[model samples]
Target: MHLFIRATDAGAPPYLYAGPMTYRGHEGERPMRILWDLAHPLPADVFHYAKVNTG
Candidate 1:
């Protein structure tokens, strides 16, 4: 897994994480259980980012 992560990470080094982790909470008094979402970090949208003049 480490190798795979490294390869993917190299492919796109700007993103913090490439996946999302989710889990369901226990029953609550409101008759609805809460779902938890955990993620490492948000990635930058290069499509909408300003272009730099490297020239």
Candidate 2:
């Protein structure tokens, strides 16, 4: 999938977010989890995650 992110201070979405991420978060260090779920659904027991980190 093609991902595009922009720098902003207003803090709202409809855009990919960026931050100092923690490993404790449910989706790990990935920023594409939500979109991935919508674009591609998988079984609850199945693990198929993807990541695309950029500034």
Candidate 3:
């Protein structure tokens, strides 16, 4: 799955988010989580999400 992130005044680049994330199979499908705070990285159990260029 892919997520669209907006450009911020912060020095970080604008990009799409992805992750080798592992979520609880709630119902049947896994969910995606976006990590906006780059300074403080989130774990894989939560979602090691990152940004990538789409356009």
Candidate 4:
């Protein structure tokens, strides 16, 4: 499935298209941490932004 990510909902920030991803695995029932192998690698800037903002 395709993955889309955005840092925030404010204004009209466009969602970064993460491309199609394949399900790798998952853990836990409550939290459900999942692993996906992305078809295309995310750009360094986008990856950094997502990590910083989300983390």
Candidate achieving the largest lDDT: 4
Between candidates 3 and 4, the lDDT winner: 4
TM-score-better candidate, 3 vs 4: 4
RMSD of 1: 12.0
Candidate 1 clashes between residue pairs 3 or more apart in a chain or in different chains? none
Model 3: lDDT of residue 35: 38
Which is the leading candidate under TM-score? 4
lDDT of 2 by residue, 1-55 (tens): 3333442436645455222333332454655343232333333322222222221
Question: What are the per-residue Cα lDDT tens digits for candidate 1 across 1-55?
Answer: 1111222334566433345556747676878766645455333443123222112
Give the lDDT ranking, best first: 4, 3, 1, 2
What is the total number of backbone clashes in candidate 3?
A: 0
Q: If both were scored by lDDT, which would come out higher, candidate 2 or candidate 3?
A: 3
> Least accurate stretch of 10 residues (summed lDDT) in model 1?
1-10
Q: Report the CA-based lDDT of candidate 2 relative to the real structure.
A: 0.35
Candidate 4 TM-score, C-alpha based: 0.79
Give the TM-score comparing model 2 with the true structure, all chains together: 0.17
Residues 22-49, candidate 4, lDDT per residue (tens digit)? 9999999998999999999899978887
Give the runs in model 2 whose Cα sits over 4 Å from its true position.
9-34, 37-55
Model 3 earns a TM-score of: 0.22
- Model 1, runs deviating above 4 Å: 1-19, 41-55
